[model samples]
Target: MQGPARAVQPDEVLKDPQLETRARDLSKDLRCLVCQNQSIDDSDADLARDLRVLLRQRLVAGDSDAQAKQYLVDRYGDYVLLKPPFKTTTLVLWLGPLVLLLCGIWVAVGFYRRRGAAQGETEASIPLNEAEQKRLSKLLANERKR
Candidate 1:
């Protein structure tokens, strides 16, 4: 059985089959304000239902699909769009992850380089003096006694 939250409702169905189809398609492309992650069509929120009705009204008023979508986008901003267009305002949304990844890689590389330099300094070819060798031997002898 279909769940209570079906994408389209019978009561909201349009008389014109073609317009109904267009409205359904448009609804699927709209993000639900309340659900955030779900399309308006798939969401059970009251806001989603209101938006669906508004979409149908636009279609019934002879608005083209593009016009209707633009109307909603203008009122709600690009957040209402399920797939936002790549425009100047949304450029950061599209590239932010790549920018963060590159930054993380740069930080990791610098950390490793500094760590390697420290390691190289500690592993240098300097030889220990005789006094230091004798101190080490004395420490080892004390350890063995303990």
Candidate 2:
């Protein structure tokens, strides 16, 4: 009889159901190195299957969830974990957007200040000439009538 296709292959299942469950959960948080975007649990790649076996082995060998995940991280350089720990290597990934936003704001503020300076020299600080003042008054009078 054919059995169901499983994310955790039948042969890789641990004798202890509890440990197998832990392995399954851990697998969901592990990135498949081959697929890049898929978790080991969801990937059908050979590398993902190997990772699943390795995870089950680790759990059966008495490693806690954190220790098992750390073991994979150590072997694969943190890229194997879907959510990598915050550290020097990932600092830019964590802070890059905020840093870019601050830089943009600083640049925009400087540009605005320069624009204000240019505008000040043009007409912002100057009194209107008599002809311009008379034209403005006539326009205002026409607006009041409307």
Candidate 3:
């Protein structure tokens, strides 16, 4: 089995506990570009390590959490944020799943309605000719006798 994935390295940790905490919190919100679904804090990629170091450096340079995040956002676009702001540029990311689900539901309803209509048309009784009706009655009589 592989070893556990270590997120923060000992050397990358800030001397100040408070600053380290802030950095950790910030890291959790930042997305790892290499691992799109994982936060930088959770990723073991080199880029994630660099981002963690960069974040700590920013904190040491007296940049607020917001400012540090904005710096990364400026470089990487809103995709760097795990919870991206709902804006025109990112509209599709926010709404695409909902739109697709609604479209699928609409399609399924249409399919079912068409199927029901087809069944209804096929199930409509056709008037039998006299000979066929006589034969059907004879079959029913035979069934009753059995």
Candidate 4:
């Protein structure tokens, strides 16, 4: 079952189809401040509605799509963008996961290596068969006798 649909309201639709389409495309790239992960176009939160209306107003006011996006970025910072530009400020966001994965892989490799070495030592220390065990016992007995 799906949750209740929460998207653009009737009042939010632009009269111009082209402008509406553009607004929709732009909205998809914009993150809803309230929902964080959801695009404004997909959110029904009041803030999302406000952002949708603001976007349409910008388009109707003869702002280019880039200008409209930039205006929002200026107001909300790059967090408003779903795909924020790669920069020093967002370096962690882009690279943190990869670093974590590499660290995990390194740790796993080290653990396996240590485990294999321990197992190898354990195997080498054990007598392989009854004859080997008897030989080891004789060697120990001779050493004690000496």
Q: Return the top candidate by lDDT.
A: 4
Per-residue lDDT of candidate 4, residues 34-105 (tens digit):
999999989989999999999999999999999999999999999999999999988988999999999999
Error of 1 at 10 (Å): 2.4
Candidate 1 lDDT score at position 22 = 87
Query: Please, what is the TM-score per model?
Result: 0.71, 0.63, 0.80, 0.76
lDDT of 2 by residue, 1-146 (tens): 12323566778777776787787778888999999988998898999999988887888788999999989988998789788778999888679989999999999999999999999888777899999999999999999999
TM-score of 1: 0.71
**Alpha-carbon local distance difference test for all models:** 0.89, 0.85, 0.90, 0.91
Error of 1 at 113 (Å): 2.9
Query: Number of clashes in every candidate structure?
Result: 0, 0, 0, 0
Model 2, CA-based lDDT = 0.85
- Comparing 2 and 3 on lDDT, the stronger one: 3
Candidate 3 Cα errors over 4 Å, as ranges: 1-5, 125-146
Model 4 segments more than 4 A misplaced: 1-6, 126-146
In the range 1-146, model 1's lDDT, one tens digit per residue, is 22234867778888887888888888889999999989998998889999999999999999999999999999999999988999999988899999999999999999999999998988686678999889999999999999
Task: Output the lDDT of residue 116, model 4.
Answer: 100
Task: Enumerate residue pairs that collide in model 1.
Answer: none
Arranged by lDDT with the best first, the candidates are 4, 3, 1, 2
